[model samples]
Target: MRIAFVHRRGGDDEAVLGQAAALGRAGHDVHLVAADADDLRRTPGYATARRTVTVTTGHGGDPVAALRALRPDVVHVHHVSADPGRSWVADWTGPLVATLHDHHPPCASAGLHRDGRYGGSRGARLPLAWASRGGTADDPLLRRADRLIVLSETSRARYTRAGVAPERLALVPHFVPDGTRGAMRPEPVWVYAGRLAQEQGITELLRRWPAGQRLDVFGGGPRERECRAAAPDSVTFRGVVEHAGLVRRLGRYQGLVLPGRFDDGLPLVYSEALAAGLPVLAFDGSPTARTVRAEGTGTVASWDASLPAALRAASLVFPTLRAHCRARYEETYGETQWVTGTERLYAAVVRAGAREFA
Candidate 1:
C-alpha cells in the first residue's frame, strides 16, 4: 500500500519519521510531505520514505498538487489545521487519518494553558490568537477525518469534552526508540529536557529548586534568555541539543524533572528519559505524573511546599525506578508497539472508508 504522511511542522516530526520507516520496512510504500527539510534531516530513518516532498503550505496548489500526484492509499495528517493562510490539505478524498497531538482545535493554547497555568482564561490573547492570520480551530478538519488519533487518555477526554465523538478517537502513545540504559548516578543529579515556556513551570521550578540539588536544563525556547538569566547557580542551561545527543545525555542523569503543569499527552521527552533508564519527577495529576506514579517509574508531588521533599524522596528510589522505567518502555511505548498499532489503524481506516458522522 502507498501512504502519504503530511505534517506542517516539526513537533511530531520524529514520530512521523518512525512511522514512515516502520511502514517502509513492512513493505508498504510511504511518502512524506512536510513544510521543512530541516525537520526531515533531524531524524535518522526518514530516508526510508519512498519519496519526501517539501511544500510551502498544505493549502497551496503546490502541496495539494504534490499530494494528488501521489494518489496515496491513505493520507495520515498531523498538525494540519484550517487556520486561515496555514490551511493545508483543504479537503482530500479517500481515507484521512489525523492525529490530534494537543488541544489546538478546541483551545488555541493547544495545551489549554494560559496565564502560566493550565485551563486559565486566555483573556484578550485568546481572541487575538484566534483572529490572527494563522489562527484556525481544527474541529472541522478533525470531524472530516476517517480516524482521529490521540496520544493519551487525557487528550481523548479533552477532545471528547470539546464535542469530538469518542468513537472517532484512538489512544496511541508516542514511539520511543530504544536507548542506552545507564546506571543511576551515585549523586542526586537531575535534568529538565524540554522547552522553557511559561506553561512548562520551569520558571517556578528554577525559583523553587532546592539549594543543594543540581539541575541541568536542556532545550531552548522563547523564555530561554529570561530563564537562564534568572536561574540560580545550581541550574545550568545546556540550550538545544540534537535528539540523539539529548538521549545520550539522559543516560547520565539520576532523574528527569518535568515541571509542566498541563496534562501532556504521552510526552516524547518523558518516554525518552524512561528509555534511557531515568525516572521522572513531575507535578501531581498531570498525565506524565500519573503515568510515573502508576508505573512506579518515579515520584510526583505538588510544586509548592511539597516539591523539595518530593525531589529528595525520588532520589532515594532512583535506582529501583530506573529498572522499571527501562522495562516499561520496552513493554509499552517502544517502536514495535507503535508500528504495530499504527499499521492496524491505517488498515482499519482504509477498510472502513471515510465515514461521516452527523
Candidate 2:
C-alpha cells in the first residue's frame, strides 16, 4: 500500500519517521510529508523513505494539495498542532489515521502533569469531561479521523471517555529498532536520558538519589540549573546526546532511570532501553513503572527512602533481566510487530472507507 505520513516537525517526529521507515522496510511504498528540510535530512528515517515532500504552510503551500498530488492510498498523521484552523487534517477527506503521541485535547497540558502532579488529582477525568463538552480546540479534528492511534491503554481510556468511538481508537505502542550489537558487559552505572525537569522527577531523583550510586544524566531542559545545583557528586551531567548516539550507548549502563512522576503514555525511551537489552528503574504510579513491574523488565520504586533499596535490588538482578528486557522488546515493542499491526490497521481503515462509499 502507498502511505503518506504527515508530521508537523515536532519533538516526537522521529518516532513517526521511524514508523515510516519500518513500513518501507516491510515493502510498502512510504512517503514523508513534513515541514522542515533540516529535520528531514538529519532524522534517522529520512534516508530510507521512497520520497519526501516538504510543505510550507506559511509560504502558501497547502499540505492537502501536496498530499492530493501524491495520491497515496492512506494518509497517516503523526503529530500536528492542536489548532484546528492551523491543522491540514481539517481539509483532508480521505482514509486518514492519526496517532496521538501525547494527551492534548483531554489533558490540555499534553503531558498530563499539572500543578506538580501526574494527571492532576482527578487524572484525565476533568479534562476529558471538558473535551467531551467540546471545550478543546482539537476535539473536532480528533473526531474526524478514520482512526485514532493511541500509544498506551491510559491514552485509549482517556480518549474513549472523551466520547471518541471505541472502534476509532487503536492501542499501538511505539517501537524502536534494536540497538544492541552482540553482548557486552554493563557497568554499574545508571542512566537518565530525557528532559531534566521537575515533572520528570529529576529534582526528586537528585534530592533522593542514593549515595555512591553513579548516574549519568543526558538531555537538557528547564530544570537543568536547579538539578545541577542539587545533584550529588556521584551524578554526572553528560549534556544532550543525540538519539542515535544515546541508543547506541544504552547497553553500557546497568539500567535506564525514568524518575518521571507522570503517566507518560509509553515513552519512546522505554522501547529504546528494551531494544538495548537494558532494564529500567522507573518511579511508582507512572506507566513505565507499571510496565516494569508487570514485564519484569526492571525495578519500580517510590520517591522515598525505599528508592535506595530498589536501586540495590535492581543491581542484584540486572544481569538476569537484561535478556528478559530484550525478549520483551522483540515480543511487544519491536519494529516488525508494530509494522505488521499498523499495516493491519491501515488495511482495515481503508476497507471501512471503501465500504462507506459503497
Estimate every model's Cα lDDT from 0 to 1. 0.70, 0.75
What are the per-residue Cα lDDT tens digits for candidate 2 across 1-358? 8888777666665677678877877888777776564555776666655254323232222367777777778888875544442356667777889888765444446634321233335664554455534443346557678898988787787777766788888988888888778777899899998877767889888888876999999988888999998888999999987778888899999989998787666677888898889999888888778878888898888765577788898899888989999999999998889988999999998988863210
> Best lDDT goes to which candidate?
2
Lowest lDDT 10-residue stretch of candidate 1: 53-62
Cα error, candidate 1, residue 87 (Å)? 7.4
Candidate 1 regions off by >4 Å?
A: 35-64, 83-91, 111-138, 181-187, 354-358
Judging by TM-score against the true structure, name the best candidate: 2
